[model samples]
Target: MIIHKSNNVTVFQSAVFQLNTTVVATEDLILVVDPGYLPYEIEQIRIYVDKIKDDRPIYLFFTHSDFDHIVGYGAFPDAKTIASEQFVTNNLKGSQLQAAINYDDEFYIVRPYQLEYPRIDFMIKEDGEQFQVGKTLFNFHYAFGHNHDGLIVTVESENLAIVGDYLSDIEFPFVYFSFEQYGRTLKTLKSIFEKNSERTLITSHGTVTSDQSQITKRISDSYEYLEFVKIQGSGEQFEQFMEEKKYIFSTIFRKRHQDNIMVYERECEHS
Candidate 1:
């Protein structure tokens, strides 16, 4: 269902994981970001796009190569796909992504669409690559750490930032990649927020906020959590931190947090 809509942008939230699918409509073309999840969800996005697209080109942009984010890639065959160069390279590996899809398929007990990786038509080679679609301009920045191929996209006209899988209110830093890289990425987000104070920040899994104070608080919270993990805090400290944040405190996230601690320790030892 539609979560938020303005004059030019519309955001749809999926039932699973609260994953966001954003559509930015312009006079010349329509931009779809991270269209995803179950079959019916993708169908709903397609229907909405069809209604407003009307001969305009549709550009599909994936923030990263996560399975849930790319599950709906096949739904829009005609869309010109865009992603970071790293994301393109990761998708070319095939086996890694295929295994993830297979796992999801088995777990969900459903296969609504033929599971295939995205075919990238446009690759973002640099941090601030700009793409012009008629009067609208989209600037892409490399956002690693959460994942090697992650990206943060800024729509100039809308003053909106679409961040994938980062700055989530419900989740702490997952640190699938390098912990140091994640720290650097958060710094980059801080800089982005500082420069674009008026921009509305949108995350893949949480609420959208235009409040500068809220953005600042989220950045600080994430940085502090990273520090806590880096120092290899005690289990009691971890428990206290979890309670303070009121995180879901589930076994799954707890295990993930523990795994992050192990990875951080190993990396520290190597360094």
Candidate 2:
């Protein structure tokens, strides 16, 4: 599903989880971010890229080392890849690939391209790292917690931030990694949004919002959710903070909420 489209940026959402894959094109370059999910959906993205890419170089930007985010890597063999330095050196490389393979096996899905972890041609080594392609400038910031290797890419040229698997309208925090790091990540995002009020946000799941107010609200929601989780981790649950956000909370995310509590508690234990 093409959620947002223009001459510069095109956002595609997959049926699997409303997972988003964004394509950003400029005068001299075409960039693909986290191409993912089903085989046909990836083909849609691949075909579309070829259609507009012309003779300009194609670049693939993987926000992190997650299976869903990297599932479509095989389809774009000719494109150069970009990812965080941590992502390049991730210890779970095999496990990530196995998860993708497992998903395909369960669905009996066959693809023309081989399933493999993406090889990064360019790595974002530090926060505030800037890379220029043609006339477009990309700013990479560390966005950890949801995952260790996540990087928030700010396309200054497009006034867009491509955040991987964070700030979703349909879900709350899914702390698969460190809870403390996740808390810091939210603070970092809040800081980012506070400064770049004009930038549009392309979260990995759910909505692609350009509204500054909506973007600010999402950051606020995340902070509220994080504090509530912290309260729960302390064994002092006051009326359940999630009660107010029932619109975004559901059975699936509630499960993730429980997981978040456990992750937070464990972090407290070790910290």
Q: Tell me, what's the RMSD of every candidate?
A: 1.8, 2.2
Estimate, for each residue in 207-270, the C-alpha lDDT of model 2 and write its tens digit.
Answer: 8988888888888888777887877742224225445555443556666777888988888888
* Residue pairs of candidate 2 with colliding backbone atoms: none
lDDT of 1 by residue, 1-271 (tens): 7888989899999887889999989887999999977778889999999999999999999999877788888889989999999988884448656865776767773655677888899999999899887788988888888878999999988999998988888788888777888888898898888997999889998777888998888888899889988788757888888888777746777898888888788778888
lDDT of 2 at 27: 87
The TM-scores, one per candidate, come to: 0.94, 0.94
Instruction: Give, for candidate 1, the lowest lDDT window spanning 10 residues.
Output: 91-100
lDDT of 1: 0.86
The 0-to-1 C-alpha lDDT of every candidate, in the order given, reads: 0.86, 0.86
RMSD, model 1, all Cα superposed? 1.8
